[model samples]
Target: MSININSKLDSQNSFWDINLEGELDVSTADKLKEYLHGLVEQEVVDMKINLSSLEYIDSTGLGVMIGVLKKLRTNDKEIYIINPKSNVKKIFTITGLDKIFKVEG
Candidate 1:
C-alpha cells in the first residue's frame, strides 16, 4: 500500500544508491516517479536501485521505471536494478524488460 524509498548520492555525485521497500503499484507509482525525476533534474549520472525489500510491482510501476530510463538515457545515464525479489524479477523477465534494464542478482 505504501512504498518507502531510501536514497543516497555518492560523494562525487556520479551515482545514486536507492532502496525500495514495499509494493510498487498504481497507488505508489507516482511517488517513485517524482523522486527519480527530481534526481534526474539534478543531473544525476546514474542510479543503482536495490529492490531486495520490495514486495511487489505492477505495470504502472514498470512504466515509471521505463520513463525514468528514457529520461536518463537522454543524458547517457543509466539505471541498474539490483537484488529484485523473485516475483519482481519475473515481471521484468516476462515483460522482456530484463534486457532493457540492467538487472543484477
Candidate 2:
C-alpha cells in the first residue's frame, strides 16, 4: 500500500524542476503526465527534474519521461534529472537512460 506523491516547483517559469516522492508505477504515472503535458506552451529552455526526493520509478514512469522528452525535443528544449537515489539510479543505468538524459546531483 504505497501512496505516491507528485509535486513540482517552477524556477522563474523558465525552468521546471519536478520533484517526485514515493513510488511511480503504472497506477501513478499518469499523474506525472498530466502535470507535465501542458509545458509545450511555455518558453522554457531547460527542464530539470529534481530526483533527490524520489523513492522509486517504474517503466511506466520512464515512459512518461520519454513522452515528455519527445514533446520537448520538438521545441528544442533540454531536460535533466537531478540527484536520483542510488537504487533509482540503478534503474536508469540498467535501462540505459542515464546516457540519454543528463543526470546530475
Which tens-of-lDDT digit does each residue in 1-105 have in candidate 2? 143444354656777766677777788888778777765455445688877777888899999989988888887877799899998899999999999889896
Number of the top candidate by lDDT? 1
Error of 2 at 60 (Å): 0.4
**Model 1 residue 52 CA deviation in Å:** 0.3
Clashing pairs in 2: none
Residue runs of model 2 more than 4 Å from their true location after superposition: 1-13
| Steric overlap count per candidate | 0, 0
Clashing pairs in 1: none
How much lDDT does candidate 2 score? 0.78
RMSD of 2: 2.4
- lDDT of model 1 at position 6: 93
